[model samples]
Target chain A: MAAKYELKLGAATREAFGKALVELGKENENVVVCDADLSKSTFTHLFGKEFPERFFSCGIAEANMVSIGAGLASSGKIAFVASFSAFVLNKGFEQLRVNVAYSGIPLKVVGTHSGISIGEDGPSQMSVEDLSLACSLAGFTVISPADEPSMFALVKQAAYHPGPVFIRAGRVKVPVIYGPDQKFVIGKGIQLTEGTDITLISTGLMVAECLRAAEMLEAEGLSVRVIDLHTVKPLDRELIGKAAAETGCIVVAEEHLVDSGLGVRVAQVVAETSPCVMEFHGVNDTYAESGLPEEVLVKYKMTGADVAVTARRAYGRKK
Target chain B: MTRTSDLSELQSIARTVRRDIIEMIGTAKSGHPGGSLSAVEILVTLYFDVMKHDPANPTWALRDRFILSKGHAAPVLYSVLAETGYTPKDQLNTLRRIGSIYQGHPDRRFIPALEASTGSLGVGLSLGLGMAEAARLDKSPSRTYVVLGDGEIQEGQIWEAAMYGGFHKVDNIVAILDNNRLQLDGWVKDIMGIEPLAEKWTAFGWHVIEVDGHDIVALQAAFAEAEATKGKPSILIAHTVKGKGVSFMENNPKYHGVAPTKEEVELALKEIG
Candidate 1:
């Protein structure tokens, strides 16, 4: 498969979210934002600066911010609550479960600085279980956009979609995967490369890595299918099943714990729909040390090369 | 000020609400009777006279919203809702039954009339504050009322909301603390003391108004004062008995979650009358 889109350096997804939020604020009068003292870090400060009246700063309380978002959403407002993934999803898990998810309020929960990619701050700040936590809550749409462009599109879509949406955004900049014209649905996967030997399924920053791995495997004359699974919950089970059936081998790479990350969900779909040899590549049961994002990814074996190695192993085990 | 006849009428409604609470909990065989009994007058006052809401148009944009933060007291809210014509009075018997609109806690999913699905403590004030902020944003003449249990306030999230409401000077929401002074285990003070509570809320920048929880007139006055107050939220520290009407259940921790027996229910109904 030939690559049609050119990969370029882009800002972090969180940065794109900030820009998109400002755009959303201008577009809709009811669109409001809430932040838990991490507005600067999450880039929601951009929206705050543009629409101070619409933006609510809930100090350092994530739990309060979540309930406030629910309250605002209940009263005909498109509320987006922003905080670090670890802080928002973890600190406000109960509130998310009760006020938002259980009550079925259309609150957009944006968790920035997700996964080991948020380096130097250490594991305390890194959220390895946010996807699992968000997915566990029923009636929550869990989205993990691959890059800035996708983040912008999905943020707009999420606001329009009337339900509780948890968007996992990253702090580090990465290569742009989608163009400005690329359209994204809430529960669909974008197949970047077409092949049948094996499939590299990934989300978030790992999608770029999977694309790189596909390129590496193509050089070795191995046909590889690369899928960018941006939405983790309400997962594109159709695409995953098709890939599993056609390729007969699957490798899921994410910047989260392998135990309960996208791999487990993908494995479930594959097991139920189409059985396949599978390999999960991510931060396995252990936390990565404080270092640069690239250094931590390498140390935790979450780079393109690592995914490629996992793909090769899974392909070799293919029947 | 609440007129003399109106106060007596409100008291009569409260007594009937208390009777309904005892009967509903008695029928369900499991519920928080103590807290529900404790919050009757407060909820009855809001739903009947204080709040600007219409039962026919439950989700009216301009209607004042009531969030039962102490969700265990769903019987009281449910009874008051029925009394105010939000739901049918007969549905009270289906309190905790399978597929009932009234769950063990207040779940808005089952009953759309509910402003927020709240069973978990310490989260409703924030939810109400959000609604209040929304009302302010739209310049709607609507207020948000939240009922907080004394034990429920023990949750750190309540203080977080208090800090936000007080710091932001949110004026459109009013929080009424059902200071029944009793929790499931025992007395709130013996379990986890929240003394100097009025000072705590005042320091948090809320217009603190202490009143007797069972006093409908006092609650009405406080809600009126809260509506008039500007630049900050209000908290009415409603000092109330855990179980007001029933003799055996009054201030009894055993009745916090235990439903009344059939005989006890009959006695309670007589006492409430």
Candidate 2:
């Protein structure tokens, strides 16, 4: 089945997360959803509407919501706690770290409106360091789906995962890159395009922008490979290593802080295995102000044009 | 009131658990004895009479869940668990050891009987509420009991959880506040006075009851009352001496986190006896 929206502008990943939760709720009565007053924004309200008994609103308390999710998980129910990335990971870091992570329980921490894409809400709302916080937690598997279809797929995967998982979802709607039937495997990256000169590794909304950047590079007589590193923590080492070896150079892009997100993770993978020249494209270690999502991307150097420029720099640095 | 024989048995068990807590901490040379000593009768009543749990079947889905939100009081939980046959008696001595499952804080990963891993204070009530919610979903009568420290209530998360439990009408959650009145540094009032505590919980819509924590029968009746209350969660504000049973340690903040010396442990054990 095709997406209901225009294929060029798909729904937000949070919308897909909400829909998938409703589906899971129907399939398993044991599935429960918790939200910290962002049920509408996080899209968990859809699940709430479908299964009111299974949904819990923790008000604006993300810390309580997180530990409650742990409580549900411990008692043999799949609990998905959704909130803005910054509030959930940064504000509720201790609860997530101790109650969920240390217990090694299976809790799906859906951090919506991640990265600088959650524009107009100011830098405080943006989750630029969410990946860093999740990575610091032991036994937490982190996944940031590139689009709506993958968000639903990865969320289903997270439900079945035995340990804690953090899914980073964006606020803005983007192009429909994956099909309705696309399957997502956690801890793996997907290669969207093939090129020889430079591999563009990106995640979340940046995947679509990276694909656009690859098209732009191809038009200029350059070969640009685009790979979506959906799973940030596990860091698909084999795919990144192969891309680094084949492409010889890599440009990492994301709508997150360059120091601690997909870029730094991809750089580490390549640094350990292939030792390729890398150019980073992301929020350059500074807070981004409120603006349109696209404008925020441009200002943070995380747009399609930014990826293309960084890819060129990586290609130039190649031996 | 609980039967005289039952209360006597529970009181005896509390004394044993108190001695065990002192010995466990005194042997390890590092633990929060004051808090553990304060929470003795609360845990003993819950494990021995109030809760529906089997030591052999700790993972039974319908078993009541008890989370030590004030994780520093692991000595009390460990001692109680040992007495209840959930853990081997020898394991109590191995607490805080490198390879021992008896961690300084309750780690559910290492100890399966523990409902949640908690050390960083103020998260347990939320966890208990979640378990209670899950029990509601499953249509199970199983309840969740969370033990909190007076000092630990200073964490904003506890109040946040209190609000959620009250607003959600989570009646299956019964939180017992170990109001030992002392934290690691000093008295709770001097550090952060949480006075009118009963009014605060009542305002949050919880069925609040204050009881002398050392009274086993009173503790048991409070648990029964908590279970009897409907449409809202309950809080048993257990008024307790910081270092109960041990004369020298009573109401002393110095013993809050410091273990007793071997001689002090002997004296404390004799006092408990």
Candidate 3:
């Protein structure tokens, strides 16, 4: 599929969460949200405003917030739990693993401000390995929605889909990619461009960066195929296999640790299915220092130029 | 105007539930028997007497909710649910088997009646608080009951939940602590003591009731007192023996999760009889 430039004058990924949640509320009254005092920050407060009765405030208790989410789900309610990735997926990790994921409750977790993207808010607030933590759960579907439209589609999908889901969005507004009518499926990858030089697979905010990187690479006569892998758990194995077979080289970019993040999940599947030379671009196992979001992203080597270099290296690896 | 005096019949039913717990775990040759036996009275009371729930329709929206926080003791729950007709008694034997809906831990996907996956302790009460608070918000008149293990309460999260339950004035939530003293490691007192238990509940702004967990009437009374309390959440600190009915494993940590052998199960059934 050819890359379609999204109009991003003011739209961001986090707003899409609120926009879609409002839409979900119109369709299902059972749609509810529980926030751990980060309702506005994560945009879950939108659901609260639309469906006041269905909203629950845990008042900064992330662990308790998850417990409440599990309770609502038990009563056959569709509950979306929202908080910062640091607290929701990290502090509330045990609760997520035992209470929701293991229980297989219809709890959809939406965590914003993940990775170094939280920026000057400092290291404590940022979540560098949120994806690694959530992806480990056996039945959990880990997603890092790239643009606004995909976030909307995934939220609707999560509301109807069974089991636990982690929807990773960033506080930083990303470009709006798909229109309202764009299609989305769990375990399916959206192919943005086609190329035989190398396949660049990116997740979350990194997808937008890679898309820009792909454009730059095209100008340099290097054909790069960019895949926005929003869902990281079921991990579009078919698309990945096909990419490895055709492109023969891959670069995995994410906003988490290089150790066990989306890159590692891709490694596991590629190693078993089709072996390919792959380079991972992510936070290199070190916590971020206080800086702006853009500055930290560059320092952490997760910017578009960094991905472009990694894509070139991946292409270079292909005999 | 009188609730049926099914005391004798209920007593026998409790005995039967205890037997079911031991037999099912021993047959499966895996499960926490001590904790399961310890919670039998509480389960019997909820299923046979207390807790407004429809066994026929476990998914009833407005039904009162319950979460077994100390999920290691799932055999007791499986047995009680069977007795209540949520599932056939025959399904009890399929526990802990691969592909069996029943796993080592309670899974909501497998059992709709189960509120959350529990094995990790001190979490069920928080979940119950959510349900109870939701009920309050909806003015649904339905209550929430969460059962926490004595050892499980040692977790710091339990204290967090206890504090939140009171701060929110979750009157509809009942936190039941099965004070069985024994945990997976050893006697809870030796591992880590939870002293001044009643005072602890009182400090947390809960209407505290301490009772003999094995005595059905004491439980019946305590539950009523909880309902009557105003402006506070309730906690029924149930004093119980770890392995109550089975003679060999009573108050013994060895039986915490070790499945009884065939010979042991036979002896256990005979002893209960």
Give the worst 10-residue stretch by lDDT in candidate 3 chain A: A1-10
lDDT of 3 by residue, B1-273 (tens): 112337887788888888888788887899899999989888888777888888778778678788899999898888877788776788788889987767787876677767667777788888887678667766798988888998898887788788888887889988888999998889888999998899998898899999998899989999989988878999999999988999899988899989999999999999988
lDDT of 1 by residue, A1-319 (tens): 6255456779999999999999999999999999988899999999999999999999999999999999999999999999999999999999999998888898999999999999999999999999999999999999999999999999999999978999999999988988767889999999998998999999999998888888888889999899999999998999999999999999999999999989999999999999989999998898778999889888998788888899888878885
What C-alpha lDDT do the candidate models reach, one value each?
A: 0.91, 0.87, 0.83
Tell me the lDDT of candidate 3.
0.83
Residue-level lDDT tens digits of model 3 in A74-154: 666788889888888877888888777766666888888888878888989888888888888779888888887788788
Instruction: Pick the winner on DockQ between candidates 1 and 2.
Output: 1
Best by lDDT: 1
The numbered model that scores best in TM-score is 1
**Which whole-number lDDT from 0 to 100 does residue B270 have in model 2?**
87
- State the DockQ of every prediction: 0.92, 0.83, 0.55
Tens digits of per-residue lDDT, candidate 2, B48-84, equal 8888888888889899889988998999999988888
Q: TM-score of model 3 relative to the true fold?
A: 0.90
Model 3 error, position A209 (Å): 1.9
